[model samples]
Target: MLCTDCLALRDQVAIYENELDMLHEEHQTQQLTDIQQLKGVKNPRRSGTGQLGSLRADRHVFISDSGAKGTIESLVEPSDGVATVTVEFPTPDVTPTILGIKEYYCQLEESLQFEFKATSAVSLGDHKVAELAKGPKVAVTDASKVTDVGELKNLIAELQRELADLEKCGEELEVEIEERKEVYLEEIAELQVRRPCGDSQSPPAIGWTCVCSCVTLCCVEELENAQADLDTQMKEQCADYDELLSEKMALDIEIAAYRDLVELEEDRLCYL
Candidate 1:
């Protein structure tokens, strides 16, 4: 239906359109590549000196993605809009621990406190028991000539009063310790607000030095007074505890001796 020249022109036109379509697709591909490269690029804002502060081009930037590890060799943007991303092929395979470092430290601190309290209590109890043993032996020797039930009853009542006083002293010391911790924590919180991230010269920072120091000193003085009070109370209570223990040992000996005398008297009557 067509001549040879016409058919040849049609063939040339079809080839040209195919080549243009191919060029358009190649251009689209190049654009997409450029876009992807720009996605990861970042511009470091210049500081007052026209130089980037705290932005080191050679600093190693750690990157982990999809089990792949990499280091950013340089963050400088190039003329052709491509970033030099240096990446190592394989990453170290370290198993994760059940507890993080912060949690582990917290748990460790708690355990140490528990251990300290438990050890101190046990040692004090053992020492007191040893002292009581010595007291009872001495009391037995002294009780050979004493035999008064009324006197023993009075000694028992006095020991109970001393125990109650010691318990009250211990309770007061515990309350003071709690209060000291609270005041210290409050001071720490105030310090944190005054200087966040350890930057003392931060903008808009209020001058809190005078007031904070006064408050802190007051708290420290209170803590010191409480500690002195606790020391005095402990000394007084320990002395009282020792004296009461000795008296209790003597009372117990007197009671036992009296019981033996009564039994002996009863046996003599039965013989009659």
Candidate 2:
């Protein structure tokens, strides 16, 4: 987070971190340690930020006079309610296709694009960012200044590192999700076609199918193999995401300490 991807988290990192702290503090004794010890992602003993609960995707951090709580909530509210999936093209000129899930869990009444810019406004893609960039590079960022010239420079540098990381993670996750979706879809088709005919055979159980283990597998063996792969992938993602959460927790403490340090230094400078 310190090196890469914090920039994408720009506005909402504080709210998520703060709420996590709130939940942790609420638990009092060994709850925090319990969370730390859990090797699996599905632990119900811990609080739900609901996949994200409080954590917003793609944060970009800055020092602002406005408190972190309100600032984060304002920034993420629009984007949080909607889950958007977009397919990217290798060609830079072409825009990616925005996709809808086969099963949507929510009912939303809102805009065409689910994402937003840092301003808490309805901002669009790279074109708008490019146009904004045509002005002074620091123009937008300068508005949120809560630090001296040196600190602002450091913040900008940190944000840039985060942006690169965010892009990398986003691309990786997209590729994986799409690949799994395609594999499952193909298996479904094959299984339906190859399904046993007549009253001689009984249909397979819902969870255990020839086409998809979680869905329908072309072969029962194939289902087991696919599920094994999925299990491995899930374990890997859980580990990675757990690492991220750990980092976030550590960062939450560090940032608070940094704030204290900055304030103390400010006071010492004033004394001089």
Candidate 3:
């Protein structure tokens, strides 16, 4: 008793439902892959060759606050996160200066209490000792005086603004994804309701079944094309979302580093 157009609409709905299920499965697999990739990535800040990695014994460096040239005697990391660095000056009468490193690095100009400039050689050894004894000491730049507090504040503020912007973009993308899903669902529902058989109550005319079959075939082809386009778009959106998340993670690390630097600077100023 079913008309040709009604049967075609039923077939279209089944095909669409199957494609929707496949798309959902594909999206879940893609999400799992993205998560695995994220886990495999290593944070660059904690790497061996990072800024803090250069701290070692016998390295020639000059204190930024005090223009005192010295050699690192030892670097120790205790149970506490803060590290301790012992620097030995050439004068036998002068005692070694013990510095606390709260995630501190020598080369950064932002360092308030201490800044270390590492020489290429591990130990200048006796040559540096002899040179120090000769009394024409190596010139040490007062990096603390050159550091601009205002500039650091501005940099931190800029980084915070960028982080906020990225967060907003991520939220927008999520909303967009939801909106696209709703739109696709609405379109599918509309297609079902607009079927020729659903609108017309009268009996079929001569050769009407043939015309309905041709129309149904065309609709099915269009539906397949639309599904393909939707799948491609969803994949692209997911990729973009993943990329944004990675960038957000990097920004979070960078923001933490800058905050640490600011805190260290403030601590130094409090003691002064």
Best by lDDT: 1
Per-candidate Cα lDDT values, in order, are 0.47, 0.37, 0.41
lDDT of 2 at 117: 30
**Order by TM-score, highest first:** 1, 3, 2
Each model's TM-score, in the order given? Answer: 0.29, 0.25, 0.26
Which wins on lDDT, candidate 2 or candidate 3?
3
Expressed as tens digits, the lDDT of each residue in 1-272 for candidate 2 is 12222333322334434544554455433433443333223322234544533422222333334321111111122334552321111111101110111011011111112212322483434432211111112222331222244555565455455444444544554565567667777777776677676654545633235435544233444434444444443443444444344434445554664465456435433422
State residue 162's C-alpha deviation in candidate 3, in Å: 22
- Candidate 2: segments with Cα more than 4 A from true spot: 1-145, 205-272
Clashes of each: 0, 21, 0
Instruction: Tell me the TM-score of model 3.
Output: 0.26
Ranking by lDDT: 1, 3, 2
How far residue 199's Cα lies from its native spot in candidate 2, in Å, is: 1.5
lDDT of 3 by residue, 1-272 (tens): 11232344345445644654565466556645754554444433344445432332234545545443433344433223343444343311111211222222231223211212232234544522122111222232222232344544454454445445444544554565566556655655565455465325423432454465556556555544444444443443444445334434434554575575456545433422
Provide the lowest-lDDT 10-residue window in model 1.
132-141
| Candidate 3 local Cα displacement, residue 75, angstroms | 32
Which ranges in model 3 have alpha carbons more than 4 Å from their true place?
Answer: 1-210
lDDT of model 3, residue 96: 20
